[model samples]
Target chain A: MAGEIKCNNCGLDNKPGAILCEVCSEPLEVTVGASVPIIASSSAAHTPASAVGIIGRACGLVVGGNVIDREFELPKDDFGFTIGRTDLDQGIIPDVDLTKFAEKVKIGQDVGYTVSRKQAIIIRRMGRLYLRAIGGAKTMIKPQNTDWKELLKDQEEEILVGSRFRFGGSEGYVIFEVV
Target chain B: MQVELTLGQRYLPITDEAEVIFLLRLLRDSQKQSADLALDLRKILDRSGSMDEPADGGLTRIQALKAAVNESLSLLRQGKDRLCIVVFDDTMKVILDPTIVGDINAIKKLIDGVRTGGSTNLSNPLRYTLEDVKPMDGSLPKIIIFTDGNVNAPSAAAEERACLELARQANRLGIPFAVFGTGIDYNEKFLKNMAEVAGHGSYFEHVKQVGAMRLRLEDEMENLKSVQDLDVRIGITAEPVVEILEAFKYVPQQLALPVSGKIVKDEFPGLDVRGQAYLIKTKVHAGKAVGDFKIATIALSWQGVAGAGVKSMNVVVNFTADEKLISPVDKTVRNTVLNTEGTKATLSGQYNRAQTLFTTSGNTGMAKKVETLAKSDEDAKRTLRTVTVTEANKGIIGKKGAK
Candidate 1:
């Protein structure tokens, strides 16, 4: 059952371990199922809505509100995040009241509110992962897409039924799947 | 596509997380409907009261409120309308604070932790709420108060005074208030009256039907309108022919002035200010197209300067059409009558009624009170006033453009 995964952007078929499409240089994320069957199962059931809460830490190099350098760090309980002048300059200026942003992303660190445009960038990290689990062990899972509602809702039944669970950490790992 | 908008407006904040979350949720929902809401509950709520009440729901007014509040919280959550509950009996406490109802266990825990007992001091609780709801700068602040009765301790009057001060602060800060009375013994008149004064609505409910109360709360919350740079003021023209006397009131008619304050609205106000252009809407009179009418002058004194400790900016508007000597109402007689009638009715507590006298004349009350329980409070009598002016010659006469 050797199958090839093709890149939509460059129309390139990348190898199992390929980081980028060999033909067009597009980013290619590959997962090996033999070693981690859970990864394949999780991907099949992934939803976009869960991205909001699953996002434990995000490093966005914004140049004008549009993310230029977007990275989701692994969930860590103590890594500090900053939305400095660069973050503000990149596009969306942070307000003193971080309610809107906080709703989209759970804020666990002291956000840099005074960071001016261009001079500051937003480095959002977390102090602890606030996720629910079946036996108290944090799960290591990631969805193919980042839509918050669909992710959370599709997992709602799994979450409320059986030993199924979902969890996140300060390390940016939002894991929740039925094993 | 993500569009970024910059809001330079300033406001106070509530350091308490739950309170902030609760208020913010309410604010976000309201923002979807109206674009000009500017009241910050954080700053006002943070001023007085305990942030946490011991988790216990016993036989007392607090317990009754606990149950009612719990039901309301559920309704808000199920409806996807965010809500927060802050309970203050003898002390201020964040019972449920601000928690989204997606998690069943959290909702159960929040509802189950309701505590009872303590003196009912309304001022501190309200102050704390106002302080805790600092709107995300430029966002209008709105608050809903649920209480058993008047201030509980000997400092009742003092608390009322504090409430008056808070109302003034809310006016300056652009926050509105709504009051709720739970339980039969609760001070319905006082709470309702205060809601009228604070430019918010009021609700009364017994322990049995919190479900009904929840609906009322939802109605008021839904009708809230957001506005920007809304400043209102009153001024006199020629010092009185019939001893013109003095005029006082709450604009948009929901708030009750401290004493003998005339006029009130059971719901929200007009003028949803989401954009920049200041749309000045007022009624004008044409008269017989030939006479002189007396006009009164009014002004909206900007307080942003006061906040910055800078000099205040005052903008003046005349009710008269003719620009005569030293504020004389020597405009067309019919015009003066129409404008003067509006000014009189507004001051006399018939603002909304007067507005309708010309447009529709009959739809007097928007959300009327079903029951009026008596409590012998002089404040209620003083706050009630009626509008008796015709609308044919009505027009808005004030500063058109001043930031």
Candidate 2:
């Protein structure tokens, strides 16, 4: 009974020694007994001989354009990560680098704007992944067999395999695939 | 004012549930012994061109509005309430300065003389009420705007933004900006957002019927008389791992959660007496181990009627989680979540989703779910014989062609 912790947000009582809230997925700060084991299994926990198995167990993004083609491997960390262009002077290095494409292109009389500096963010919660738009730019997500949904700024949607996303008003698209 | 706080659930089972809803009911003790609070009330009545069109029965829309305003005016305490009347069409006109409610003849004369003709311009009267009318010392200042048409001038988007901004400003100044939309032609979304931003106000929908409209206004006036406190704010302090998903205020409106807070402090505004309830959805991380833990402490602060100093109350809940103990879900909390979520889905035009949630929960009665859905969806009305067209017209009626 001493191990049980109540969630402050939803007022739901949780079993003693829970690290994350059962209801809201919030982190529980209560200490657990020594016998309690952490439920989450990370890639770092693998033995040295099987460490190579975690190499390609990640989601990747492919950005293709008329003259540009690039690939970026998403972080395997459980936490949420940002995807945008890098700003070295400001010490801003995004999880998925797109700095090479963050420029205004001019070909004859046509002009084009690049993806924003803080374009989109992918968050993993309770083993589920979600994508959110940042910097007020429009981000559209198209899941397989579903129409594209405009991911409004700050609105998060779950990402699935075969899902594609485009940022701003640009023509380049990023396909989400497990590699 | 005395405050009583109760939570819908005190125990939750440890599981992988993504969201938990806790319903907080704030009940104000009877204040019959206290004298009526002094109030500075202003009424903004719309007299647009459409007001001349015939409503249900033979009465025009303006005629119905005038009748309702007159009946509601009689309910205000004569000496304690000071009233101002403003009429608007394409522009706003101040027909009466601040006058005592005891002067029924003068008020009635102005109400009878209100004429209908011109495009609907909602921003002018709202701007005037906020900028020109100064608040009386020790008296609650409130502006009630009644309109029956969409705001058509100065561009709809610009007008909506201005109205919302004004509502926010009025809220900061402790002025309640209530808007009443009559008939099906008005922009309910704009009015609802305006009332919500005003913090301590609400948006009311009145069917075009004159008799029902009068009764609704009278009921609103009666409710206004029971104001024990105004402009109430509740501050919640939670542990680092807890996340608040939503906060709802019955007096003002409902708010989707995570409600703009940093790590330690989350604030919910626009609360009032007359028994308001807030359903909060939160998540608590199961930590490394289970032990007795302090979840959250809620501090509610409000200004009592009659210019009483700000009063505060603190409610703290603590629980211990043990794997051996089986925790039954709280039905009251569960029902509240179902109802709130159902209503939210209906308002957002997700009728099928709302119905699916209702059916899956099975905790809420089918009749109640149908009634809730019928409040916003016309299609749902076909299944419920008791639901009237007017009742079904309560929610946002987007633009002419919008879904």
Candidate 3:
């Protein structure tokens, strides 16, 4: 805890020297010293992740693509949410459960469950949010005005203001908006 | 005909030698010339064991193919359009030659009787169909293929190489071609790469589902009908002797142009109104003049149903020492460039590079897709590349080209 910065927003442990919560992009407290470093990281100083969203504004989600019309609110206060199919016996329960989205979805059935237990996750870093593609099945993303493609699991790319995320079987999909 | 040239970031720092992407748009008013083309179209479909598997809407993949083919035959004009049918399993079999579409019932009956057989043989069908796609009665031939399995004749690699060779031949012949890879079993990258090798008027599609194949084929059919006799030759020159990096036919469908030189060039055979815009990459030198300067020139000529004409335009960008004058890249342009570069990486069998490019381009979605495919089978990796590249190019030019 000495070197690590604890974000006042979400409680995920962040890498050392992080100016914002890696999970919830809220700014961590900085100490005033006699000699300030030449510069902080440009993003960490200029546009904290919270700048893109209100302190408590939730992330909007819309699920489509063969799945029934389903919408849910990803609360800003929670650590984060996942998009994946559910397998209860394996203790695999996604935050934004794909199987629960609709009974019409084939992903929930026994035969062709292509969606992984944990496909993608939305979180923040140094006051900026990002989407990390993870899970057993394939994951894809589409920014506003662009066609659907797979999601990248990286630290640099941030989620655009209007973007959609899809994973798992054919019926697995979710559109994301930073409201 | 109209030609306009634009830069990703209009202002370049005068001090540093810069490499920038230039967007070129070609627009034609085709509404007044609504004359339809007399087309010679050929369909090469795969009838392997996998074709019988259940797909969307409870119909078999073969059934979906038949329905799409039947619907297409009904729209063909008897005298104006001719249709050819070929099926491949262990070997290529011709069901019909370039025959005029007279009775829809007869053509449908022929298609309905084509039975599923042995393993997929891609190279033979592609060669047989593309080798003889000469214009009949002044009607240009359009060869469209649909397959749902990998080449199993000798091996996938052997067949893929053979197909690419045949595609190069078709490219030299000015023949138009399109291919659709249905279901997850097919080698999408090989088919796409093969078609792209045939250059002008080549289209590729990844039917993610067998059920969706019908709609995609139908959509492509409409696109084919709309493709009139628009033969275009484009000649582009850079002022400071820039390196022509890459060019893409950005609208309707995203296909990379084969460009190599200080002066870039491209051609099109029977282009459609739905797919006209282009994006080109160049490393241009900014002179010390500082203010506004002309960097390039675009010359375009086309012969279509409306007649033949030539048009040209000058591309201008600012060479500024003032950092304030430099503008951030336009979002649409940035996305397109990334998609193009990512696709290039995928085509070259560089999955990691493709993933990185996609990640940076803001479509992290494709990055993940590439990552998963990067760890799979060789053929599966090829599919990932195919879908990754093909899917990335969708709607890149927008409806009206980049305004």
- Among all candidates shown, the one with the greatest TM-score: 3
The 0-to-1 C-alpha lDDT of every candidate, in the order given, reads 0.30, 0.54, 0.61
TM-score of 1: 0.35
DockQ, 0 to 1 scale, candidate 2? 0.01
Each model's TM-score, in the order given?
A: 0.35, 0.59, 0.62
Cα shift from native, residue B183, model 3 (Å): 4.7
**Model 1: CA > 4 A from native:** A1-179, B1-33, B36-84, B96-108, B131-135, B154-172, B182-210, B225-290, B297-403
Candidate 3, superposed: residue stretches over 4 Å from native: A1-179, B53-59, B122-124, B131-134, B138-140, B152-162, B183-189, B251-253, B321-324, B342-387, B391-395, B398-403
Poorest lDDT segment (10 consecutive residues) of candidate 3 chain A: A33-42
Interface C-alpha root-mean-square deviation of candidate 1: 32.1
Highest lDDT scorer: 3
Worst 10 residues of 3 chain B by lDDT: B394-403
Query: Candidate 1 DockQ category?
Result: incorrect
lDDT (Cα, tens digit) per residue for candidate 2, span B1-403 = 3333433333334443223344454444433332345767788888989888776547888887787777767767888877888999888899888776787877888899999878888778888877887777656677878788888876777877777888888877767765666556777667766776775544444343543456555545545555555556666655556666557543333444346552222232222223454556566554532334344556566555445334333333334345444333443344335545555565665655556544433322332445353564332332221121111211111000000
Indicate the docking level reached by candidate 2: incorrect
- List model 2 lDDT by residue over A1-179, tens digit each: 34357886677777532333578644344421111111212113322323222233355555451213335544232224466765432223455666655556554686644665567776542234567775444578876568888987546776655556766455443444434
